[model samples]
Target: MKFLLTSGGVTNPSIRSALDGLLDKPVDQCTALCIPTGMYGHPWVGPGVKAWEFVAGKEEGNPMVGLGWRSMGLLELTALPSLPAEGWQPAVRDADVLLFSGGDAVYLSHWVRESGFADLLPELTDTVWLGMSAGSMVTTPRIGQEFVGWQPPGGGDDSTLGLVDFSIFPHLDHPALPTNTLAAAETWATGLGGPAYAIDDDTAIVVTDGGVEVVSEGTWKALAM
Candidate 1:
C-alpha cells in the first residue's frame, strides 16, 4: 500500500506537493480516513467514541484515524468515527484509501483490533493507507510499547495490528508542543531491540513498494532490524 506517514498535518506547500505526488489517483478522487488526535484523551480505552458523537459532533483533524471515508463521504458535520458497533465487516472491508490522523497511539490500536478493522486490513490491498501521528504508530508492529507509555495490564494482551515490522517514536526532540513526553516511549523502544523511526514534528516517512523513504523539511533517522 502507498502511504504518507506524516508527523502531523501537511501544512507546508512542498510537503503538500510531495503528498499529492504520493497519490496514484487524481487529486479530486483522492479520498482518506481521519483518526482524531483528541481520542487519546478519553477516559475509557477502546469501545471508541460515542455513536451519538458521530451523528452530533464535528472532529477537526485527520480522517483515517477518526472516521472511515465518511468525512470525504456524504456526512456533513460529524463526530469521530468509532468502530461500528454493528461491526466493520462491511465498511472497512472495501475502503479505497485510509488516512489516520494524529492521536493517542494506544487508543487507535485498541479500537482497530477491537473493531476488527485490523483483521480486515489485509483484504483492502487496493486501498492506500496513510497515517499521521498515532495513526502512523499503529501501522507498525507494536505501537503501545513505542508510542504509548503505559504497559500491558497484569495479564491482559496488548498485541498490535502488525502492519510494519518497525516501531515509531513520535514527538521526540521536537520543537513544537511542549507538553509531549519522549522519555517513556523512547526508553521503551531502546530496549525492544527493534528498529525505531525517530521523527521530528516536521518530518514524514513515505512508504511504497520501492521502500520506506524519509522525506521532510528536516532530518530523520531509521533504526533498522
Candidate 2:
C-alpha cells in the first residue's frame, strides 16, 4: 500500500513533488476520487441556503486540481449509509488515487467503518491514499484527543481504521491550529503506545509498503512512547 499523508493538502513544492512521485505517471493521466465525508463534522450555512446544500455545491477549489490530477470525482461516503455498494465501489476501484479532505477524525472514522470502505482497502493495493489533517488521523490506530478536543459521539470508541500503525499529529506549531503544537504532540505521544509523527502544513509522510519517508519543506518530528 502507498500513502501521501499531509497536514494540509499539497501545500508546498516538496509535497507536490512527493505526490508526483507517488503517481509515477504524468499528473494529467491520473484519476482521483475525492471523499469529502470528513467535512460533515464542520457544517456551515450560507444566506438562503441549508448547510448541506452549501457544502455539497462547493466541491471546487480542491487542492488536488491545482496539483494537476485529471478528472477528480467527489464521493460523499457519509451519504452511502443507505445506498447500495454497487453505486460507489466501482468509482473507488477505478480511481488511481483516493483523496480525503480534513475535518473531524471521529466523525470520519465512523463513516469509514459504516460505509464498508475500510474492508475494501486491502484490495486496493495500487491506489494511492492521499489524506489531509483528520483524513491523515483516521489512518492510524487511534485519534489522540489532544489533537482534536472533540470525541466520538455517545462516548463511542475512539479507534480509527488502523491502516497505518502510528498516529499522525498534523499542523504542528501552526498558529492557525493552536491546539496542534509540538508540546501537545509530545504529551500525546507518551500515551500513544506506539509511534507518532508531528508534521507541519508543508510536510507529508509518504509510506510505501513497509517503508516510510518524510517529505517536507517545513518541520516534522518522529516520536515514540
Candidate 3:
C-alpha cells in the first residue's frame, strides 16, 4: 500500500513531487476522487444551512484544484449514504488517487466504516491514499484526545482504519489549529503506546510498501513515544 499523509493538502513543491512520484505518471493523466466527508463533522456557523452545504461553502479556495491532476471528482459519502458499493466502486477503481480532505477525524472514521470504504481500501492496491489533517489522522488505530480537543460522539469504537501502525498529529504550531501546538503534540505522544508523528502544513509522510519517508519544505518530527 502507498500513502501520502499531509497536515495540509499539497501545500508545497516537495510534497507535489512526492505525490507525482507515487502516481508514477504525468499529472495530466491521473484522476483523483476527492472525499470531503470529514468536513461535515466540523462545527457549523450559520443556522439554517445543511451541514454539508455549510462545510462545502467553507472550502472555496481549496488547494487541491491546483495540484494538476487530470480530473478531480467530489464524492460526499454523507450525502449519498444509500448509494450502493457498485455505484462508487467504479469511481474508486478508476481513480489513480483517493484524496481525503481535512476536518474532524472521528467523523471521518465513522463514515469510512459505515460506508464500507474501510473494507474496500485494502483491495485498492494501485490507488495511492492521500490525506490532509484529520484525513491523515483517520488512517491510524486511534486519534489521541489532545489532537481534537474533545471525545468523539458515542465514545464507542473510536478506533480508525489502522492502515498505518503509528498515529499522526497534524497542523502542529498552526495558528488556526491552536489545539495542535507542538507542546500538545508532545503530551499526546507521551501517552501513545507506539510511535507517532507531528507535522506542520508543508510536511508529509510518505509510506511505500512498508518503508517511510518524510518529504518536507517545512517541519516535522517523529515521536519516540
Off by over 4 Å in 2: 43-62, 148-154
**Whole-model Cα lDDT of every candidate shown, in order:** 0.55, 0.77, 0.77
User: Following a full C-alpha superposition, what root-mean-square deviation does model 3 have from the true structure?
Assistant: 3.2
TM-score of each candidate structure, all chains considered together: 0.68, 0.87, 0.87
lDDT, candidate 1, 65-175, per-residue tens: 233233353211113245353443454444456656555565566666554456666667666766666667767766543345433345333345567767776665665
**Reference-based lDDT, residue 225, model 3:** 50
Clashes of 2: 0
Q: Which model, 1 or 2, shows the larger lDDT?
A: 2
Q: What is the per-residue lDDT of model 2 for residues 1-225, given as tens digits with 9 covering 90 to 100?
A: 589999877877788888888885777899887777776664431122332332343433226534556777878787777889999888888899888877778778888888888778888888899988888888999876564544565776667888888899888888866777788888888877889898898899998876889998889999983
Clash totals in order = 13, 0, 0
Looking at model 3, the pairs that clash are: none
- In model 3, the Cα lDDT at residue 136 comes to 90
Which residue runs of candidate 1 sit more than 4 Å off their true CA positions?
A: 37-71, 74-90, 144-146, 149-159, 176-188
lDDT tens digits, residue span 1-225, model 3: 589999877877899899888986887899888887786676641122433342343443335544667887877766556897788878877888887877778888888877777777877887898888888988988787654532456665446778888999887788766787778888888877789999998899998886888998888888955
* Candidate no. 1 TM-score: 0.68
Taking all chains together, the TM-score of candidate 3 against the true structure is 0.87
Q: What is every candidate's alpha-carbon RMSD to the true fold? A: 5.8, 3.4, 3.2
